[model samples]
Target chain A: METTHRSVVDAQDTFTMAREQALIEAAQAGDKQAYRQLYDRYVGRVHALSYRLTADQGLAEDATQEVFIQLWRKLDNYNAKSKFSTWLHSVTANITVSYMRKQRGWVHRMFNIEGSAAEHHTAEGSAGDVDLEAYIVRLPERARMVFVLHAIEGYRHEEIANMLNMAVGSSKAQFHRAKHLLKEWMGYTDE
Target chain B: MSKFEQQLNQQLHDLAKEKAPQRDLWRGIELGIEHQHDTGTVPQNRHRRLAAVAASVALVVSLSWYGIQQTSVPATDHPTGQALVKALSNQHEQQKQALLVQYTDAPAMTENWEAQLAELDEAASAIKAALKEDPNNGALLRMLQQVHQQQITLIERVHAPQWQQI
Candidate 1:
């Protein structure tokens, strides 16, 4: 009975993959409706990724828009060597990082408004619940990025280093720093 | 992983999976796609139009000077030199305009491409002003052609498909 159920699940997975493939091909051919379908399916995951990296609602929205625009422009170059979702995630990561770098210009720093909300919330510890999202966003910029990419996104430290243009040791150290802070925030005691 | 680390990882994984933005982002995404399709090439077209007008004016001025040079001097003195220069300049202008159109919406690899292009334009202008004063100065004319070629080459190299790959 369990094997039979597993086979049914496998069949459903195959069907979903086939549907996505068709949608990708249609979207690549300039079908707006097809592209919209793709966007509807992926926007949540993409936005979530952007939010975690950026730690700001507005920046996430901007990055999400920029990512989709870039995806549409570069869709023709998406060969099917890897899964479409994997390629899409890679593109999202690159664009969101680039967006963050652009937003960190001297003007933003001069105003002392770079990621200020997260810094303020983290400092005040005013979050009512031990919310992981709240804690994740409160992490220092480099540590937050390293933690999200390494812990949440499942990227290797080396890969995170390359993505963020830092040394691998720095990525590992930042991950540890992020882990330490989250533990401290959540009141986790070492046994 | 330790028990504490495992718990942390589990919580993070759940958060990553379950969290969604507060708003429906699809509306924004749809609008963005529509905007890209509707007016993606408008800026490039505008730039090309401006370039064409400028090139036309430059061509008229240069050709008038070429005509004057042709009649005032002996044919064998420069022997199609003015015509050759005019043809090369016209060709360079067209190629530059085509490149401007091709890279109309290409994301610049570097932040200072505009500044660099402006500097090249300034250099070209200075050379052109000198050429206006000494149209028969072969060295000044050669410098102007080189500057123009540099501008096209710089624009093309920065916006090439290979840069996008990098």
Candidate 2:
């Protein structure tokens, strides 16, 4: 029975892959309707990823828009060597990072103003609902980015270092800092 | 992992599954794509205008060439319109070559942009060969000018600063 179920699952996966490949081809051929169908399919996940990375609802929305626009422009670059969803995730991650960098001006970066700003913003948004996501948003900028990319997105420290242009050790350290802060906020002890 | 860590991980997984943007984001994405599409056409429209201008110049030059031939005028009576067309074509060629040299090491956005440029060059060469056979062929002259315009546009587009960003 287990073997039969596995085969059936494999067949469904193949069918879904074939359907997505056709959609990608049609979208690449300037079919806006086909592209819209793709948007409907991926928008929720993409928006969630963007929100986690940027930790701001407004910025996440902007990043989501930028991601789709970049995707449309670079559709022909997709070679299908990997799953379409994987490629889309990589694209979204890169665009979100770049968008965050652009939004964080030199003054904000130099002064490290985003932590307080993000905390205040999150507090305002999460009036009665204090959640893990709200705490994640209150993390310092670099720590938040490292946590999201590494912990949430499943990227290794080496990959995060390259993506963020930081040393691998720094990526590890930031992730540790993120965890320590989260634990402290949640009142978790070593015991 | 500790129990706390496991709890945190599960919470994150649940958050990913349950969270979504408050608004329908497709509308913003559609607007952004439309804006990008509009900006993207600026280069093509510029190419069309260039081709139109080149055709006008070709038409005037061809008319002068025909007039001189019909009147049976002396060679020195008017400046050679053929020489003028050749000079204009040479001028465009020189500009295109300069652009090529300027962007020799610059990366192109599209993988097949060079192939597209080569195809335009081949079309221009074919038209030039036909023009040589019938020196005063007005249609061939116009086509050659249009092809030259296309070549300039292609080279400029592939080497555009924005392409490097892409």
Q: Which prediction has the highest DockQ against the true structure?
A: 2
Query: Which ranges in model 1 have alpha carbons more than 4 Å from their true place?
Result: A108-130, A189-191, B16-18, B34-40, B43-166
DockQ of each: 0.16, 0.18
lDDT of 1 at A3: 100
Residue-wise C-alpha lDDT for candidate 2, range B1-166, written one tens digit per residue: 8766876777677775425666555654564565465434324535455567665765565465545655766544224535555766786777688888998997776787777777767766665664454443333444556556767777767767883435
Model 1 TM: 0.60
Candidate 1 chain B lDDT trough over 10 residues, lowest sum: B38-47
iRMSD (Å), candidate 2: 12.4
Q: Pick the candidate with the highest TM-score.
A: 1
Interface RMSD, candidates in the order listed: 12.8, 12.4
Which portions of model 2 show Cα errors greater than 4 Å? A106-112, A117-130, B41-166
- The digit string of per-residue lDDT tens for model 2 on A90-122 reads 898999998878655543656567554443332
